[model samples]
Target: MKIVYKTDTLPHVQQVSELFRSSGIKRPYDDLERLQRMLEHADVTITAWDGYQLVGLARAITDFSYCCYLSDLAVQKEYQQNGIGRNLIRHLRDLLGDEVSLLLISAPSAIDYYPKLDFERTEKAFIIPRQA
Candidate 1:
């Protein structure tokens, strides 16, 4: 049960895609090419791997100077509640380290989770299309 962290790895992309769907999150579905493109451009990514298997991932987009948006943060179903997500957030924060603003949108049920990671709720709104 070794949890290793890394960035820019392609193999984890599929696992993350599956996790997104299984977890009932809708973005990044059915487009591995686009997903790969997006991952390639991300400012930083923190992934937790159990041995060779990717069990969790946290991804961010940033200017590396002013702001960072942590868009997708997920721990595989089996790995949840084991502090993998917390580790990912802490590592990301340390990497950013007071040099940039990190922001993330959490699901209603998960709102309290980020505050423990030092994320404060801002008076900001996000818009998404229904696409139906």
Candidate 2:
């Protein structure tokens, strides 16, 4: 299973929506326009592709100086056990370098997973929930 990772390519809404659904990451996949805006606004997007298939993705909005909000991280259910998610995080880290710290609001299902990847857990975060 040769999965190639890229930072330059952005997958279509359908591809990302499909991946999100399959990965069980709840997002506005049914709202194609919202998904399109998300893709357009993200400063960093790394995708893992098995040939033409998008198996995993890491999308973030970063200032490239201090902190990065890792807005999304998802991998196809069938591709979960592999190192795709970790590799995707690694890719983000490598790109952001030593100066930036990555922060994400973990899905309930992914709470344990982040720590395994060396993500420090912090209770300091607060968010004004999005109602849409």
Candidate 3:
């Protein structure tokens, strides 16, 4: 199966909600408005499509020059082992360039996955936690 990658377009909220749910990502998929705002505010977003179906997505909040908080990286469950997720990260890194650092908090299910993509595990990070 051939997957097309697009960075110039953003999918509709309904599409994203469906994608998030199908990808098994712990997002507020039932909240369309919040998801819409997330898309609106993210500095970078990359999506993978397979003949009109949304198969993967990556979203980040960044200053474009320094650190980038990679907020979301999801691939439809059926498509998970196909390298779509890694390509999404590669596309983001290509756009962000060498000077920018990409960092993200992995979902419990994905703790082992990120390092396979060259992401280093670090003990230097901390979070106050999201109450929602």
Candidate 4:
């Protein structure tokens, strides 16, 4: 499959929501307005497309200098395990450069996946859970 990566375009909300659902990512797929807002506010969005299909995405908010919060990384279930996710992260890193630190709160199922990608597991992070 010839996958093309793009940093300039934000995929439509419907495409993103569907990918989130199909990828088993726990996102507000039923809320299009929220999804749109999410995409609109993100500072960095990298998408992988196989022709016209969006196969993977990495969305983040960053200062382009010090820190980046990778809020979402999703790859369609059929496209998982193909290194798409890793490539997405790598692309994000290339954009952020060496001085920036990337941070993400992993979904329960993805806790183990991060370490294999050179991410350090740290107990130092804390969160106030969203009441949604």
**CA deviation > 4 Å runs, candidate 1:** 8-12, 22-24, 126-132
Please, what are the lDDT tens digits per residue for candidate 4 over residues 1-132? 988899998999999999999999999999999999999999999999999999999999999999999999999999999999999999999999999999999998999999978899999998999999
lDDT (C-alpha) at residue 70 in model 1: 90
lDDT string for model 2 (12-120, tens) is 9999999999999999889989999999999999999999999999999999999999999999999998999999999999999999999999988889999999999
Q: Encode model 1's per-residue lDDT on 108-131: one tens digit a residue.
A: 878887787778888776779456
Give me candidate 2's TM-score against the actual structure: 0.98
lDDT, residue 25, model 4: 95
lDDT by residue for model 3 (1-132), tens: 999999998999999999999999999999999999999999999999999999999999999999999999999999989999999999999999999999999998899999999999999999999899
Q: Estimate each model's TM-score.
A: 0.82, 0.98, 0.98, 0.99
Name the candidate, 1 or 4, with the larger lDDT value: 4
For every model shown, the clashing-pair count is 0, 0, 0, 0
Q: List the residue pairs that clash in candidate 3.
A: none
In model 4, what is the error at residue 62, expressed in angstroms? 0.6
Model 3 residue 23 CA deviation in Å: 0.8
